[model samples]
Target: MSHHMTKNHPDSPNGQDDISKNDSGNPTIHEIIDIRLSRRGLLKGGAGMVAGGFMSMGLSACVSDSSKTATTAKGFSLGFTAVAKSLNDVLSVPTGYTASILYRTGDPINGATPAYVNDGTDTAASFDFRAGDHHDGMAYFGMASGGSGMDLNNSSRGIVCMNHENINQQFLHTAAEAGVGFSTAARVAAQIDKEVNAHGVSVIEISKAGGTFSVNTASTYNRRLTAASDMDIYGPARGDTLMVTSYSNAGQKTRGTLNNCAMGITPWGTYLTCEENWAGYFKRPASGGLSAKMATAQNRYIGSSSSNGSYGWANPTGGDTSGTGLYDRWNINLTGADATADYRYAANTFGWVVEIDPFAPASIPRKRTALGRFGHEGAMPAPAVAGKPVVFYMGDDSRGEYIYKYVSTANWSSADVGGGLAAGNKYLDDGKFYVAKFNSDGSGSWVELNIANPTISGYATYAFANQADVLINCRLAADAVGATPMDRPEWTGVNPSTGDIYITLTNNSDRGKTGTTTGGKSRGLDAANPRYYSDLKGAATQTGNVNGHIIRIRESAKDHSATTFQWDIYLFGAEAGADATNINVSSLTADNDFSSPDGLWFSRAVPGLMWLQTDDGAYTDVTNCMMLAALPGTMGDGAATTITNTAVPANGNANQTVATIAGKKATTDTLRRFLVGPKGCEITGITETPDGQTIFVNIQHPGENTALADVASNTTASFESHWPDGGNARPRSATVVITKNGGGLIGS
Candidate 1:
């Protein structure tokens, strides 16, 4: 999500309110990058150094070490002409590719449901059978040709599980509905019902015929799990007191999952839908006599104690006629006497990685607490090796947060293929969680985040009563263990060809800012987060790492369980014409430059191919968000270098320096723009078929910038974008299928 979209509402779901309180005094990534660059004598030069200095070094192009330099993947080169940047109200793909709308917001997933009316007159109950809004982070599970079960090799038929992260309130309702307290505490019950049912995840069947994919409206597997759905709590914190709520006295169950972002797939054929920015959905006022323990946890995990909650999900009056506390559950204030009396602990039930069995629609989703609670962007599992433990890499999607990995106690086995939730119970219930600690030598270590660690149990900031407490408050433990604070860690993915893990450190506004800690914690540039400058977006001047960067780590000796790993900056997001000395460190050209890298996934069928998506605001003035294809070489492919950052006028107009290990600058042969999304929309959530011939990409929140006043006034000409179904229709978030013109491999 883009911060610029909600600048007026700081408490909005994707806003920067849920920042890190990592005052651990541990060295940040910027400091490590500075140490390494200085040790290699890379920062000795002045600020006038040219970007070509890195290209002249001629680094290795292989994705692995020197021993595997000659074994490049079969399709290592980008084959299509790069799409030019566009501000059009429609998706733009490469010249040889065709993109067709596959699914959209409010589209019916079942044959019995009525077609979407686009005028917002559809019944609130009908959205339960329709596709949710803001399509994001999807995966394809191949279906057997004979309509039996899953078949990994099948490409023509499959089920798509996608996250409907949020809704566009203005567009989803009519003018009269908005005037009836949609944005206030007295929100209309019918409007709130529609909004609540429009969130969470959606699973629909789709098939390919004549090179086009369409939703299978009559498939028995089609279903939508919304914010009001019932789910089971699993793992260490299942019966813990912290999870207790009015709905679940045993704390073993909860209603609904919110803010579902990126997703992952388990070897047992289950979907891992992560919950990001979920804290914003709760209201926790300071007037409630909040205990010190509760306040500490709330201020650290959620932001400010005076929050009114995003969208006022807790405000519908006298609405729970069924005694289910449907609307009251969103209020986390300690109004009642105990945890069982009110929903004070309801927020804790959220923010965990939820596992859903798409194949079995009746199965209940489970919240995997073993993965540690935070604003999880995605949980990317490392390739499951027989007899080895199942491993997953995760990122906390907030500024100055940490990257974490989970190693299940149970080893992987092929026999668990169809085990579903039972397999999830076996492999996801007991796991050793660790957070990354990057060192100045370019090597990193995974620090254990368990209460058993002396640093965690003996901490003075917050008391850990048990393992459940530690898992529930793992961010505090990470701070206690001195984990490295990253630059707004987002989607994480593991390279299929090399077993390397990559995490997108989406831009941080607080980086390199001079002053006492503000907007999370402030610090100067470092090796892993080396770039810091000012960006002019429209009339507003944005500072810090205006254009984010991606960092990758390779486990020692190719072992997923290794505590040590080596890391490097894979690519820096910058405009093609930015200053080459400091900002455009990646040496990107017009054909491949990007900003605020968000969604990332390495192709399972295309060997070393990787897809990079953007959720940008700084660069939106020039172009809409986009997706790019890359044959990214592995870690250590480039040398250490120095970046001399020049502060904007707002930051004192002084120059500062930092050292970083830069990857080999991307070229036209290795990276190119594949698609650009519609105006005011973000290009994210991508997956392809087994044959790599068809790819599904999600366009989130199209026309998101449209003002509520404009929608209320019916000012059609003032709309930012009307995409997918264009002629005067309201813009909608949709999933589109992209394929090569004649059904050859996509991006080839």
Candidate 2:
């Protein structure tokens, strides 16, 4: 899995647009104010760690230090740091370990299919059933042998379920080389198919022996779920008129899932993959032809044509007139006889948490509508409690969106163990979705999204049509209920040991801006999102809640279904040299400083060991994206401290902090940088064996350097990153597994 192999086109200064030219100038006054108030309250009020609370909890495993020393205790050794220059570079680990590519873009998983050519020309038919690209969040589920959940010690064969976030056009096609100029309708179709194939999850069986792991290519469990695969629609929105189509007369089923990002596995053995950035994959007709209501919906969801035509799928066939059915699907226009006859079905299909059974190859993944959808990042289930309902936490990954929780209607029972579709029918098909609203007094309420609730039914803000509309347009529903908007809520990870939920609020730049505010939208900061500062180095260009922060919520009764909870900020992202007065919240220093925290996962085997990975561009000038492992204490670490940003006068509270292990300075040792990635590579999608002996991580989009010509030889060398290539070579986005040579637990 070399980064070079992932490049479909040579590096060039005039590369495909990266910053999403879709920017409609600055956000509208309403959008700006909505984001401003949400961020202000989140950071300033609700997110502070209580200083002295966790001390008596017996979690004092370490103290701060000034030197870089590998503190080893209880047989666990702090692993060596691996350096990667970019997304294309190969992984570098400690001397005793080795790495391999278990899977990559276009890898066939059905059977005797040819290996991926590592070029951009793979056939679309083949990709219709193959693994997707930009692998993100993933989980490793040990297979059950002769019934009961596989014995933790005897489990040698397991299913590796990984999410294919999005596609990289430069690495997937050769538009420039094919003499087929990029952006044409035909060119866009090819790119669309390639991306559509690469957007779901790949479930492959993997085996480990002699301290090394490899894909069991011939295993029956190996499966690839592409965007074309038919999936069942479940929950309140299922079978609704909004989802009906000629393709699905029942209206309870959809064609496929797209933009599948981070994922989670339920205790019952089902995989939950989320859809993020799904809005960018659709294309609405130009403004003049659309109704005002329809136009507003289209613009609100996807954007205008200036947004690049939703991957160009509508181009080749006829630019919405392409008679070819394949090309016509991407054209989200209303020209057909009716909504069912046109691509309106496209909008109805995406944006839900899809459930897949890795063991059932013939099974169609189900889009669980019960979990209200809107840029779903990941779904983490709380440890199952006997007789109680299953609680799953999720985040809507967008600036000024809300966090959500789904409580299954069915109670937990041992009979549901390994129950497959039946279990999903019993639990996932019906559930209550709730949104978080952190109060100023430190307590929070999970407002139920039920149509029967007065807050929802009697609300005068946004119309509460029905449960279907609520789930389909969850952001609006959350806004109506006054759910606290967050700074790009990305991933949510539940501590297996404690039911505490950790959410990554990847930076939001719209906060603090003032303008004509819309109904139900506030204009200042509050408790949940409370920081506003300009990066010192690029102050002129950057503003708002730039660095971002991690928020942790503790349920009052340790019950996932509990509506009330306490909240705090685990850590505030900033540069090492940030001014203590404004920037430093947890009092962080050089050894561990980060920004735009994205991918987050908590090890089931290692209770206190939480892993944090970053996908960032704002702080790239100082350091590349990274992954850190933390031995975090439970909630209540810092006292409430207000954060005041002159630009946006918001009130923010500080979270609890302890001495850093790297330096005796008072900070949050509960979070620390475990690994740093190569240049331009986002360190994400991590999984480890149940024993914690083997770990697998994805290094995505490595050599994204901005300059390089079409020359095959020269363009490859221009990018400074060559990851997974131990000897200064081209980088490739691939998965690498790190295990101890002596066959011991990782990070131990």
Candidate 3:
């Protein structure tokens, strides 16, 4: 999850912090956009969400002060005792559940392709037609049945699409060894080609027969979208000057999608593959940095001033000039004789919401830039009600970032179910964008990001010329408004049985790091962001909210497009041995304790059932990351909690020593651990069939801690795990399908 922290992508400044640069455009294009989120409150001097630990409550979203229980809370039991934690290198489920390998890295896609050899000898070219590394965020699109759109109940046969978040270098090459960079290896063109081809998303067909699920590679729907595939641009910014590349002088086209993390499934039967941490993958020449127009844009998202990236694909020891535009594409330095001559504008094409149709392999993907670009974690849609505007909730996965939402101009309808890209035009594009502001007092507001608003137009900190400029430089716009900064925001999930939406705030080490955070941002404990602590892992001390927590919100009046919301902390992640009063604020026991809430999903087939997964470091000493099942109660079920942080203080800020936080608590009967993964692994990427009888989950980067020196001997003993392919063999990122041994509904 923090892979970007280790690698230096000279051309990509995706996660790095930088100041804004210059722009060349007409100064009056902001006239055509929507601006209600700001005009109503922010522009009129309305108080925004602030940095306070707690505040007195005064209002409500739906339920009144007398009772905080949501109208749709589920208090049913999970029905199973929690699974025991273990260090074994295998996927474990409840005793009645069985699991099998569905697919793994290097696995072939069609009948002509051979099986995965599970070694480092496979040809780099072969990976172009195989499953990729680091599987993440997937959704099941039921069979379209030839033009009637999709039947959500078609559980027998369907299409599955998933993201290949990033690469695992040690296992990706033929002669990988410690101390030698995979991209720096001799004659790395082939190796570079393989990694690039394997970094996007894959669409495969799956069908159930008798009792097992199998991939039908021969199906015409089987396909792969690499980082170099041709795609069209959509939304108001599609034909703008910022997108004028040699590939599309008209600024209507671009190539490939990169760093795809979490994704979303649309009600219109399409999939939204999110581009995350995409800024730091390219390098710009120092001289090119002089072009304030381009540099200004790059600095906002962090464009490195070097000529190489994490892999040196553009400037490898072996000349990149001989390749089929393959190697040169990685370099975004202005050395390109012109926009067309070099990939100077190539970086502009990435970092947007990419829409793909899994049922139609021949269809071109569209980069919907109107969604307000940043390090998009994922997009989760509110319940789609006919005649109502579709609402999508998204999070920017970075430290001290803001949460956003997009409200479509078009209303929902069944007729547009199979409309495909046309449906995207009706909903994904031309929307009102707003950032969230959480108040310590339970109430929160959605701050509009409209340039026309006086709050934005009157601000002199940054330049906002038009709607296109506003969308391109969204982070700056969010900052101009008083959006509440948060911990590392990850995946978001919404309850179908209830209108409540939940977002996972992964741990943030910098929270309350120093008295003065230096960047004008405060890291002190606030009512909305309550906990701050330090933890010891081995010899290193992990600080801030080490275990992380989950926040749930209900829209005012239960309306998806409501500008206000009522929220509370749903659960606080922690180790079973942690203090119940301070660390384990949710009062979690051995059966429900967990940390670093990362991946979250609601069972589409099982109403009221939510699946919670983790990607942890603070508690690995006890067991690896795992997934849990919860029958969640409403946000107001429990009383507010107060934490007295007693850690070493820095900067000018002293120990809070006392901070009262408000949030509901989770009981053992309401939530229980369902499965534990192997050592050195993260449990992520989850989905299930419409019937809820079969579920698919990804085990990413297993045995990732193995040192390169240990793997040189090429033995299973050199690694920390080899389950799912037991015996002396290398471990691979794989998708496991789990089902009840007696055919019961999952989580039933």
Best model number under lDDT: 1
lDDT (10s digit) by residue, model 3, range 12-126 = 2233411112111111101112211111000001233222211111000111111111222343445544576656665666655556778788887787778878666677667
Off by over 4 Å in 1: 1-26, 29-75, 518-520
- Give the TM-score of each candidate: 0.92, 0.83, 0.87
Model 3, CA-based lDDT: 0.71
Global CA lDDT of candidate 2, please? 0.64
Candidate 2's C-alpha runs over 4 A off are: 1-100, 128-130, 144-155, 175-179, 184-191, 286-296, 304-308, 318-324, 458-462, 516-523, 536-540, 646-669, 705-714, 725-731
Better of 1 and 3 by lDDT: 1
To one decimal, what is the Cα RMSD in angstroms of model 1 from the true structure?
8.3
| Per-residue lDDT over 633-659 for candidate 1, one digit per residue giving the tens place of the 0 to 100 score | 888999887788876666763466676
Q: Model 1: which ten-residue window has the lowest total lDDT? A: 58-67
- Name the candidate, 1 or 2, with the larger TM-score value: 1
Q: Model 3: which ten-residue window has the lowest total lDDT?
A: 54-63
Per-residue lDDT of 669-738 in model 2, one digit per residue for the tens?
Answer: 3345555565677778898888887788887766655233432333555646545443333345667676
The residue-level lDDT of candidate 1 at 650 comes to 65
lDDT order of candidates, best first?
Answer: 1, 3, 2
Q: Is candidate 1 or candidate 2 better by lDDT?
A: 1
